[model samples]
Target: MSGNEISEVAKGFTYLEGPRWHDGRLWFVDFYTCTVNAVNDDGSIEEIAVVDQQPSGLGWLPDGRMLIVSMKDRKILRRETDGSLVEHADISAHCSGHANDMVVAENGQAYVGEFGFDLMGGADHEFANVILVNTDGTSQVVASGLSFPNGMVITPGGKTLIINELFGNKITAFDIEADGTLGNKRDFANFGEIGDEPNVAKRIEAATIVPDGLALDAEGAVWIANTVNQKATRIVEGGKVLEEVNTAPDGIFAVALGGEDGKTLFLCAAPDWDEGARSKAREGRMLATTVDVPHAGRP
Candidate 1:
């Protein structure tokens, strides 16, 4: 869809992230607002849950229980049938930065990511790890040596896992073993050049493709939040741009393909990434446009 064709389905938030289309609704988390909300098919919004410490990613368990990433506290809270939030796992001991996004597999295995360093605080850069949260509430570091792992998706058949390394400027993949372990780590789609600088600000200013959130299409193409260019770029297995949808006036933070026909490309956008400025205002929005390919694979 063109920039002019994109419509705002919902507005009035700080910063929206982790866009998920499930059960006929578009669910997401508002960072500064500290709320988990969903916009129904009728255009009415609903407050599904609340995350005081700040919420990022959203996923569902095998039995259909909601799993929310409590960012600052470094814990995964599971919503029970009675609407109570309980700690599913504590990952602070295994992480140096706040927990970020997560992807739950078909077998109830959840892979999560973190900053690995203090980004907002202007700390030095460091490679992060992907923690695997089992169904029994046990957590382990499944994959390491990542430059800020953000949004991820498991293939439709659950054989491979694709991850967007935000600070690394590359789309990486891992072979999902039969035992729920990740092996054969390789760059699925990598492009641009950020140089060899480890200085966070210096590298970010020099980076070419700073990927944030991403979604997989039906044809194996990946729609990524190209933060460096502030648009959603569609790429195949190789680092080739198939299409670029501009979300001007606002930067696209996340992309998801979901709707009745699964062609609705939902874009999580904001005016800027200034946490101080964003936290004081509700300028965040959930914009969307229809595309040809529907959503596939795990969110």
Candidate 2:
């Protein structure tokens, strides 16, 4: 799809990330604002949950309840019918880094990631990793030593799990076994620049370095929010660049396919880091775009 074919759906959100399509609307996390929002097709927004802890990933349970990741508290919260959030699991035990984004399977297994080292200032930074947490709260480290595990998706067939290592500029794939374990890890895509720069750290620091969100199209292609480039890139399973959708002022963290036909792409975007925070406090709107493909996997 050409860049012009995509247009903004809304605006003014603080660190918008983790877009998920559910029950006729687009649900996402406003990380800096500490709330989960639902955006309708008519462009109206609703604050569905107020999470004081930084919220990141969003998913649903087998019975259709909502599961949210509380990044600051390092816990998984389940939204109950009475409109209350309950602690489902304390993942702090297994998470080496703050919980970023996650994907839940049809069986209700959640795969969560962490920074492995302090990104926004923690301590004793270590290797980044992904952890598998069961519905009952049991957990285990699935993959380790990643640069920054951000967005993640499990294939519809349930055979593989794809994870985005933001700072590493690479998408990694792991074989998912029947028992919910991951293996055969390999790089799915390496988005490094063609020419090497002497000051890599300076270059990365200036760039968004990939941030926190991704989605799969109906055709099984991955739609990655390249925060550093301020564009959403569509890539096939083998890592072929199919298209790129650029955003205004360009600092988007997450995206998902929604709308009546699942062709509308909703973005949780911000102009930049500092400006994004201010906008979120003043106005909670987030941008959206129209894409050509339907959402992949379960909606």
Candidate 3:
């Protein structure tokens, strides 16, 4: 099976990321605008929340509350049923730089990742660990040695977790233990070469393949946003690039599988990733298309 033609669903956003499909709407955050929004099928927008420190990843707690990542401040915030926000957890001292992406399991355990270094500031590369936040709002390190872990997803059965390593050029997997902890860290998919240069800019430029955000299918394959390659590639467990969709003129940053049949693949993209440039313009867009497999994992 294969996807149909791609089309633009929404446009003129500021660096969209952490895309989630819920309740017949496409929800995502604009990095530069510092706001979360939901888009209707007709392209209308409904503003969700405004994060002063900038919002990155998003998840849903078991009780229906929304868990949002406050990037700059290193905090996880929960959105109540009444449209109010509350502190979920604080991970200020755990991450080296800003928190980036996260995934919540069936048990309400949120696995979060960070930049691991000053990526926008052009600082040296640093490996960061994944933090697990329990339902009670406490947090702890569950896995480590990840090279800029960006996006994450949990299998539908809730037994496995897979994540993207932005600079490592690979997708790593961890077995989810019964206690909601992660174990058996290993490469789920490995690309040819990683970004081994000294600085962030050079490293991003040198990478053969850069895995950013991902979407898992019913058949267990993952669709990856290959940042450096300017395309979205579908890969199997052993790192075989099965399909590639060029998102040129705009680099695909994140993805989500949804729609009536769950074949709709939402692409969050922009032409430039530089903070200064992207923040000053509304060039980002939310694109939608169909895929072979239906979505089979948690957001």
Candidate 4:
């Protein structure tokens, strides 16, 4: 499998995000359309659920229920067997901004992150927390003071959780405790230095990279969607860039690995996240390519 020879699997969406392969289909959310859908192998799509507040991430609990992230409402939603959406966990009281991506563990624990500030409103950058939601829907702030913590994945062994610190230009790892709490925060990969600027605007502008969504491979390397660089990068431990796929013009905001053998790399791309342009053109597409390694660990 190589980064070249890209293929378009789906189109006509207003910003696609939170790609996950489950039940032999590609599941994702259309941000502006407010729908969670699954694309089958034959190019047909099925509407699974809808999020009125906007959706960004998707995962599943151990009991086979779907979990969705309601972005603006800062809550995790569970889709019951009756096709109803209910609040699984409300984390708004502990978050400064919108709830974003998430990863569900083997034991049904979910680790979700937030934007940490008014990103679209041009407000100052502030650190946010990662909320851990138990199987029963109880939630707690397991890790905090993070710079825009975005996509996350739990290791196969269920001992570590890797998070993409979007504005921090790095991937951070945390020790996942037996009780579902995160501790011992450390850098897993550092792409570059984040500038120290009093002005929040300048600080963000100085960032060399912004890692958004990520997917872990069987070899322990993570394929990251670089928001600022407009590329999908494969990075292992120690900050090494093993490979990169250019998305140019359109930014690759999310990535997922899955297919019959779990080697297909799915990408979510749009010209930009501007609501005005995305809603008008609906140019978001789900592009894919095969990779050398198969997907591993939790989604």
Among these predicted structures, which one has the highest lDDT?
1
What would the TM-score be for candidate 4 when compared with the true structure?
0.96
Candidate 3 overall lDDT versus native: 0.86
Model 4: weakest 10-residue lDDT segment is 195-204
What TM-score does candidate 3 reach?
Answer: 0.96
Model 3 per-residue lDDT tens digits across residues 1-299: 23447798888888999998877778999998999999876779989999989999999987888999999999999999999988999987788899889998877889999888898887888888899998988888888888899889999889999999888868899999998888899889876555445566666666667888889999999988777577788889997878878877678889889887898988888886789999999899988887878998888
The TM-score obtained by model 1 is 0.97
Which candidate leads in TM-score?
Answer: 1
- Candidate 2 colliding pairs: 9-288
The C-alpha stretches of model 3 lying farther than 4 A from their native spots are 1-4, 193-197
Candidates sorted by lDDT, best first: 1, 4, 3, 2
How many pairs of residues collide in model 2? 1
> Which lDDT values do the candidates have, in the order given?
0.88, 0.76, 0.86, 0.88
Which of 3 and 4 is ahead in lDDT? 4
lDDT of 4 by residue, 32-105 (tens): 88999999768998899889999988898888999999999899999999999999999898788999999989
lDDT per residue (tens digit) for residues 152-199 in model 1: 999999999999988887899999999888999998898765645679
Clashing residue pairs found in predicted model 4: none
lDDT, model 4, position 264: 95
**TM-scores for all predictions:** 0.97, 0.88, 0.96, 0.96
Once fitted onto the true fold, the runs of candidate 1 whose alpha carbons sit more than 4 angstroms away are 1-4, 192-196
Preferred candidate (TM-score higher): 2 or 3: 3
